[model samples]
Target: MCSSVNAELLVDKQTFTSQNFKTFNGNNIKEVNVGWESYGNLNPQKDNVILITHYFTGNSHAAGKYDVADASLGYWDAIIGPGKAIDTNRFFVISVDSLANLGVGDPHVITTGPASINPDTQKPYGLDFPVVTIRDFVNVQKLVLESLGIQKLYAVVGPSMGSMQAIDWAAAYPSKVERMMSVIGAGQSDPWTTALLEHWATPIKLDRNWNDGDYYAGSAPIDGLTASLMLITQNALSADFFNQLGKQTVPFQALESEPLHDIRKSHSIVNWLRSRAQARATTMDANHLLYLVRACQLFITGHQHDFSKAIASITAKTLFLPATQDQLLMPYHAKQTHQALIDSGKKSQIKMLEGPLGHLEGVTGISQHTDAIRAFLKQ
Candidate 1:
């Protein structure tokens, strides 16, 4: 395991604000603040900048400890360091929190989500927050780069939802992105993926305390949120891995007069799942999860429904890394995107990652592909 303490790691959360930010739906917010963090230094040429986009539940903390005594490092700490895959010695790595990320409650992350107070109404935006898309996320990231005096990115690398944003950057601003590494992400959300996303939000919407996303001040929809997260966690890992983790199948039984007796008879796997889900539920806001889910649902490159046309606009050299066991975003999704780019006469390639971690293999299994990633970025 990689140590959480790294002397070279520069950990600090920074903020960027843009006034009159408009969403893809044409709704506008008075202003929006993006939370971000950086590692290494930008060279004088400013061309050594590498942007690392975060996954659905991730934030700007991409590769470091927030403090010396911190128990954990950032999400991609395994592959990013002074001389690791991304090579901080040769490039500046920057990561940013997406709009309405899971970090709504974290003071370190200054993002505009449903949990944020609306400037106009002087209350939480809740369901009133404008609908945001993948393109919208990329657009805001572009502003962050521009503010930092970075005109062109050496590379834009990300996994899952972050990968969607990487593809968007290459398509929307071809001249700005030199290379793109899209890991376990698709050009557009297929019907199956869209349906899954809908299911993820269903439980939250059904919660009585949800009150149509207006439960910020009252009892949060913890039960519904926990159920939703449990669903997500199940898909995030492979069946084989879960089985190896001792997950056993248990028959459902309706509780009679003694409800506690039924709970005592529950399988260990059921209890484990509930424990994990409840832990996540306590940290993340239900409304923020819904917003992020909707954002993922709307993901599309170049805002084009046709995959070929969407990828046709990409001028960056791209590498598609698909996880073979990914139950959520399958390898076929990444393969299809790569095929579309190739058919469009764009430079692209696909590399399949074999692992037991399923969708999370993009992150947990990333170390296995560091050499390939390093070579591609060097090109």
Candidate 2:
């Protein structure tokens, strides 16, 4: 495991909401704070820039960190080194933390979710952070990049939720990006992913200890949150991988197998679950999760929500890579998006990653596609 890295404070910038646009749910507009990070040095031209968007649980620490077990190379360190796929020797890499990334112990991390202080009440926002969408995420990223004097990217690369942002960058700001890569992600969050996420959120909400999202003053819904996390990890693994382990069948040799009823007896399971969940939970407002989820549910391309128009808006060279064993996002999602890109008269390609790590293949052990990724960026 990478050692925990110390938090490095980035920018703490504010943004206003779109005056002409209302949320899909027709909620009042609101501004937000965006926190982010950068790597390498921008050349005199500022054209050799690469943008990396993170997954749902990822933060601005793309490389390693100080106090936290942040890897020096970062989450995709394997592919972003001096001579690696991103080739830092040639390009300046920039990665920004999303509006609600659940980063911990990182002072430079900024979010509009639960941990943020409510401007009005002067207290933590908790569940009060307004809902945000992929557009919102992309808009904030634009702000971060522009602040750095970067006007265009040689490429924008990311996986899963980050991929959504990458695709959105191409769609919402076509001329700003020369290329895009979306790995283990889709143009829209499918029902399957959303349905399962609901299960994960339930435990956080049902924890009687959860005082309607006001658990900060005292104990949070640690127990319920852990339970939900356990479910998510188990489900995130693909059936093909689980079948090899035969998770359904207990091992014939068992040192200890007892029926324990109390939550304390099951504390080990909860602990393991919480450990994973907490890594991804960050300080997000539970309400922010709802709003983000709702925003995903409202995803539709074009003004009519027709994906044809959405896919057509891509003006950059695009690559969509999905893991074959990803039971969560599934390869079909990338294929659908790829096909839409073709239908929209866009230059795009889909390459399926072959691996057993499941959805995580996009993160862990993904160097197998590093050469291909490098080639795409070279163009």
Q: Pick the candidate with the highest lDDT.
A: 1
Best model number under TM-score: 1
Error of 2 at 185 (Å): 0.6
Tell me the lDDT of model 1 at 73: 77
Worst 10 residues of 1 by lDDT: 250-259
lDDT of each: 0.86, 0.69
**Candidate 2 C-alpha lDDT tens digits along 32-105:** 56556555568999999888988866665565443333334467877865667877668888777776665533
Off by over 4 Å in 1: 1-8, 247-265
Q: What TM-score fits each model?
A: 0.93, 0.82
lDDT by residue (1-379, candidate 1, tens digit) is: 1232445475878889999988888989788998888888889989999999989877888887777877887888888988899988788899888998886777667788888898888889999988888888888998898998999999999999999999899988999999999998888888899999988899999999999999978898999999999898998899888887873454333443345565555556666788998987766888888888988888878887666776888899999999999999988888888888888998887888888999999988888898999999988
Cα deviation of 331, candidate 1, in Å? 0.5
